[model samples]
Target: MTVTVRDLRPEVPADVERFARSRHLAIPYVLWTPEAIVHRTTRTHPDAHYRSLVAEEDGETIGTAQVGIAHDSGEPGQGYLNIYVQPDRTRRGAGDLLVRAAEEHLTALGATKLFSWVLDEPGNRAFAERHGYRASRSAHFLRLDLANGALPPLQDLPPGVELRRAADFADDPRPMFELDAETTSDEPSDVGADLTDYEAWIEESWKHPLLDLDLTSVAVVDGRPVAFSAAYTDRATRYSTAMTGTARAHRGRGLAKLAKNDSLHRARAAGYKEAFTGNDADNEPMLAINRWFGYEICATEVRHVRELG
Candidate 1:
């Protein structure tokens, strides 16, 4: 009945599957596949110093941690570790063991500040607060019935605008990267991130295992991407909008809704049965856009921060 913390064996299929299962149990909104876990571990930026740890009790993995440095941020010493334990197995010291292991790993990497996402539940918040974490912004996980629900109709773009798919720029995704960078910088969040490294964005985002280029929709004006809705799907009929945004100059033109509707229609036509997405609570425009598409809040998470001296 003793719990121990150890490194997750990426090379072991069972270990990876168990970790994914544990994550699914703890957080069901996000998709977590065995291949996705391996891809993140192997393809993440080297500067990230990413490490996956697991808490084992009686040879069973009861908790998991995703610890890494936020290398994309210009700010240094920014690290993150999200620890989730199986509900039925809590209070067995798995969470405590996992946190100790994760903190030590990140501090060793010279991380001066740490961030984590805690579920918006009393016990979860209490756990983080007791550990010296302060609650920050909150976000909602939204879900849509892609197969049976009615999606908004795609509208014609304005005179200078056109719709295109991500695959259309396979030869050169720099334009999409530029659009993503602009839109993301303006996104409402507790921490503002800059996607300055185009090459790294291409490797981590454009080539992501879940990104379905054909299903993604982009708004092009004067042959330049100004808005986009990135699509990610598992071959198993689950689809999600990784990001949906428009450039600062292109805001208030309904272009975001236009691109999102286009992506939704294409996703449903391609046989995706369930759709998932998330948004910061303060993002009223995006939240309204999602509500217009019939998305409902299924879960919520509060961002918690802890400073390390």
Candidate 2:
């Protein structure tokens, strides 16, 4: 069985589907779709030098890697490569080949440090360790039974505060962009992202294929978006909260929780069955809020870093 790695061909539907399937098999907690895979491959900023690589064994994709520089990071030379091998395809050398190809690409692009998220299982951790990566931080993937679980009832809006759907800003999404930028800067991650490019964010995030604007709930104060819960759906029964945060000024007021609860209630009413989200282990505040919504930790992944010469 010969496992070879090559760049994903976005134009080829089969290639895109296989890549998405491989990723879903390896990491089922997060949502994956063919359209989302293509968007990430082709719409990401050019500075990121993004590439999607797939490992093929006899023309069947068994593993995939999303390799790119952290173009939004303040620090230069920071790269990331998240590799996932289908559960049934492990031990066939696909993972190794995909990693090698991703590392070589980033190294050639002058990346000095690389980061990857490895599942917390022993075999996955050992794989990262053998590749010279050291674990730094961990995050949990949480799931809620949207259709069966009880959601917190919507609370009365504070004076002068209103809840609105992200679709309300379709005419001009700059406010949503501003709110996203502010919250993203504070997210806990190995590579800190500075979202300063509004156009890029519009292309890569606002217009993303998975973004469900109608389901995304936002807290509006004085006609400005102060807190939001961004929702992504598969147009079926599966829904995920891509991000939920409150602006620094609005912290401690429960606006974040308000927005998220509103979003989840609507998601359930709209027939979504399963809800998924992720949080850094250190983000106790958000984790607590998720727990209030009946979310339970389903899986974990550790961020690993490898310094390059």
TM-scores of all candidate predictions against the true structure: 0.96, 0.99
lDDT tens digits by residue: candidate 1, 94-162: 888888888898899999888999999998899999888999999999999999998887777788899
lDDT of each: 0.89, 0.94
- Best-matching candidate per TM-score: 2
Q: How far is candidate 1 from the true structure (C-alpha RMSD, Å)?
A: 1.3
TM-score (C-alpha) between model 1 and the true structure? 0.96
lDDT of 2: 0.94
Model 1 alpha-carbon drift over 4 Å, by segment:
none
